[model samples]
Target: MKFTTKWMAAYFPEYKGAADTEIPIHHIYTDTRQKTDRGLFVPLEGETFDGHSFLKSAINNGAVAAFWNKEKPIPEFVPTDFPLFLVDDTLIALQQLAHTFRTEINPKVIGVTGSNGKTTTKDFIASVLSQNYKTHKTKGNFNNHIGLPLTILSMDQTTEVLVLEMGMNHFGEIERLSFISEPDVAVITNIGESHIENLGSREGIAQAKTEILAGLKSNGKVIIDGDEPLLAPLHTREGVLSCGFDEKNKFVLSDCKMDDTGTRFTINQNINYMIQVPGNHNVKNASFAIIIGELLNMNQEHIQEGLSSIELTGMRLERITGKYGTTILNDAYNASPTSMKASIDVVKELPNFSRKILVLGDIFELGALSEMLHRSIADAISEPIDMVIAIGEEAPYIVEEMKKKELAIEAHSFKTKEEAVDILESTLSEETVILLKASRLMEFETLLEHLVEKE
Candidate 1:
C-alpha cells in the first residue's frame, strides 16, 4: 500500500465521504482509460480536455479516491461514501501530495539537470548508489512538472536514495521541480544548445539549468562540468565540485581512452574507471556519478562495478548489427549541435571501420537560428567521415556546407527518410559504420527496421 485514504485526509482536510477509512491507494493515475488498483485519480485540466469530465470512467477503472477541483461541480454519479479531497487546483494538489510523500519517506535525493546527458547521468548515479543502498530513479522521460511529481510518488517507502531527472524547455520549470524534489545533491551535467529557441541563448539555457540549485538542501553538494565556461561562476562556490577534462577542475579526468568494449579514464590522477558507453563526453558524465557515489560513502569498487554495468536508455549511442554485418550507432533519441558533434567524434575514433557514414536529420526547436545551427554540423565532419546522408529541410544545409569544403567525401541530401532508405541500405557492409542522429521528431529509429539483420 502506498498510502491510506485516512493518511491523505490529514493534509487535505476539505473532503467529503469516507475520509477516515483505511482503504489503501496502490496507484495514482490521470488517464481514466487505464485500470488501476485502488488508485487516487487526479483530474488535470488542459487546454483541450478536462479530466474531471471522465471521473465516472476513473471510478469504473478502480479509482477509490480522487482530488477534485472545488470550482467544478461534483457529478451526481459519485457515491456519497466515495472519498473526495476538494482542492483549488488538482495539479497543484498532486504536487503537494508528492512532496509530502517524499518527505515522509525522507530519501536522499539527487537532482540531475542539463541541456544533455541528464537521463544518462541519472542512470549512472542510480546504478552506482544502488550498490550500497536501496535506490530509485526517474523512469524514461518523466522529468517535467507533472512527471517529476509522479516519479516521486512512485518510489517505494524503503527507498534510501531517490535520483530525480529535472528537464525543462523554458525558464522557471527547473526551479519549480527543484522545490518539489528538494535534492540533497544537485548535478549539472553540461550546458548545450537544447531548447535554445525557448530559452533565448546558451547563456539563457545555462541560467535555466542552474535553477536546480533553487531547492538544494542547505548542506548539499553541487557537481558540475568544470570544462563548460558558462558554468564557471559556480566553480568557486562552496560545496560545488567541478568534474571535467580540464586540469583545474576539483575532480579532473585525464588519460581518457575508448575501444570497441568501452571507455577508460583516470580521475584526479589516481582513481581509474571504465564505462560501457562510448564518447569522451560520457567520461565527464561518469565523473558526476562517481562524485555522487563518493559523497554518499560508496566504495571505489562498487562505483567501478556500477559504471561497468550501466544499461542506457534506447537510441543514445546504441550499437546495432545491420543486415550485412554493418555497425549502426543509433544516437537518434535527440540531438543538439553539441551532442551531434560529440557523437560524430565518437564515430571518427572507433577502430577498424573501413568506411564511416553519417545519416543526419533536422534538429528542431532552434527557432530563428535553425538554419545556421543545422549548417554548423558540417564543421564536425572531415576526412575520417567518408559519406554523409542528409535528410529533412534544414539538414540538407549540412551537405551544402560539406560541398563548399571541396572534400573527396560522398554526400547526398533528401527531403525525407524514405528517399534515403535505399541508399542507406546499399552502404551496409562488414567494413562500414553508420551513425544516425537527429531530433526526436524525426523518428529516425523507424529507418532501423529496414537496416537491422533479421533472424
Candidate 2:
C-alpha cells in the first residue's frame, strides 16, 4: 500500500539521508490542495510556475514524502523527519518508481495503443480477464505519462491483470510509458491519421504506436488489427496474433449483426459472441479481448458472459431515450474520420426507423492534412441521414462540401457548439435519432447532454 524512500533510493541514488528519512505513503498527489496524511507529492515544474513553491503547503497539508528537484533549493518548511528523494528530473523519477513497483507486484500486464479504440479495447480486455482474475484498468483517459505509472502502482499485490492504455500526440511518449510497463501481451487497435500534426504522417503514426513493442518480452504475443493496411505488412512473425475482419487475420470476426441491444459476431466462425456495444469497430474491439481470454485458458461461456453488458462508464456508442420518445446515440466520447464514418454506418442500421441527425464537432491534431480528412466525412454521408449539423471550425469544410455536391440532405455549419446545440434541440423532431459525435477536446459531451435529453 506504500512506496518507501528505501525503494525510491534504489532508483534515485541522488537522494540523501535515505537511511534516516522515514517514507510515509498512502496516495500520490500533484496538487497541494488535496494533500493529506502519508501522501507522496510530485511537484511538476513547467514553464509557468515552479513546484518548489508548493513544497511548503504540501508539507503543511501532511505530505510525508516528495520528489525534490536537485536543481531547486530545498524548502525550510520540509520537516527534518520527512523523507525527500532528490532527483535530477522529477517526472523521469516518477516513471522509474512506477517500473520498480510493477516488478514488485508482477501483474499480468496488457499494453494497448493505437490511433483509436485504445480505451474501448482496454475496457474489453479488462472485462474479459475479470471473468477469472482480479483486474485493474486505466480509468477513462488516464493513459498518459502520469496515469500509466499510477495504474501500475495502484494495483494490489494480488492483482492478476493490469490493462494499460498508452496514448500519445508526440513521439516517444508511448516509448517511455512502455518501458515502465513491460506488458506480457501487446495490442495495437490500429494506426490512423490522429496526431498527424506532430508525428507527420500515417506511417509515422504506425511507428509511434509500434513503440509499445519496446518493453514487450520477445516471446510475448503481439496483437494487431490485420485489416489496417499499415499494420498488415508487419503481421507475420513469431508470437504475433492478428485480429480483424480479414481472412488473413489469426482471429476473424464474421456473420456480424447489430440491433438495438448489441452486436453479435462469430470468432473464427467457431464461436458466436454477443456484446452490448454497437458499430463494426466494437466487434473488432471485443474480438481482441476474446483472443486474450483464449490465451488465458478461459472457456467460451466466460468470454460470452464477460463480453455481454461490458462496463465503460462513458465510451463508444450508447443508446439513450430522449424527450418526446426521441432516441439518441451518444458517441460523443470522441471522433475521427474513421470512427465518424463507422458511427454513421451504425446509425444507418439501427432498428427503429427515424430521421438520422449528426451533430459533429471539429477533430483536433490532424495537422496539415486536417481539412482533407475533415472533408472526407462528406463521402461517408448517405441515405437515412436527414441532416448534418456541423459544429466547430474545422468541420465546416465537410458540411460546406456536402452542400456543393448537391447530395440533397440538409446540412448546417456553426462556428460555436452552443449555436449548433440550439438548432438541434429545437429544430429536430421526435422522430429523430440523433448522433452526437466529436473529438474529446471539443467537449462534445456538453452538447450531447443538451440534445434529446429525456426528463
Q: Which candidate is the best by TM-score?
A: 1
lDDT of 1 at 195: 94
Cα TM-score of candidate 2: 0.95
**Residue-wise lDDT of candidate 2 within 140-193, one digit each (tens)?**
888999888877766777888899999988889998888899989999998878
- C-alpha root-mean-square deviation, candidate 1: 0.9
Give the alpha carbon lDDT tens digit for every residue of 1-455 in model 1. Answer: 89999999999999998977998999988889999999999999999999999999999999999999998898999999999999999999999999999999999999999989998999999989889999999999999999999999999999999999999989999999999999999999999899999989999999999999999999999999999999999988999999898899999999989898889999999999999888899998888999999998889999999998787888989999998899999999999999999999999988889999999999999999998998889899987999999999999999999888876889999999999999999998999999999999999999999999667
TM-score for each model: 0.99, 0.95
RMSD for all candidates, in order, please.
0.9, 1.9
Q: Which stretches of candidate 1 lie over 4 Å from their true place?
A: none
Model 1 alpha-carbon miss at residue 148, Å: 0.3
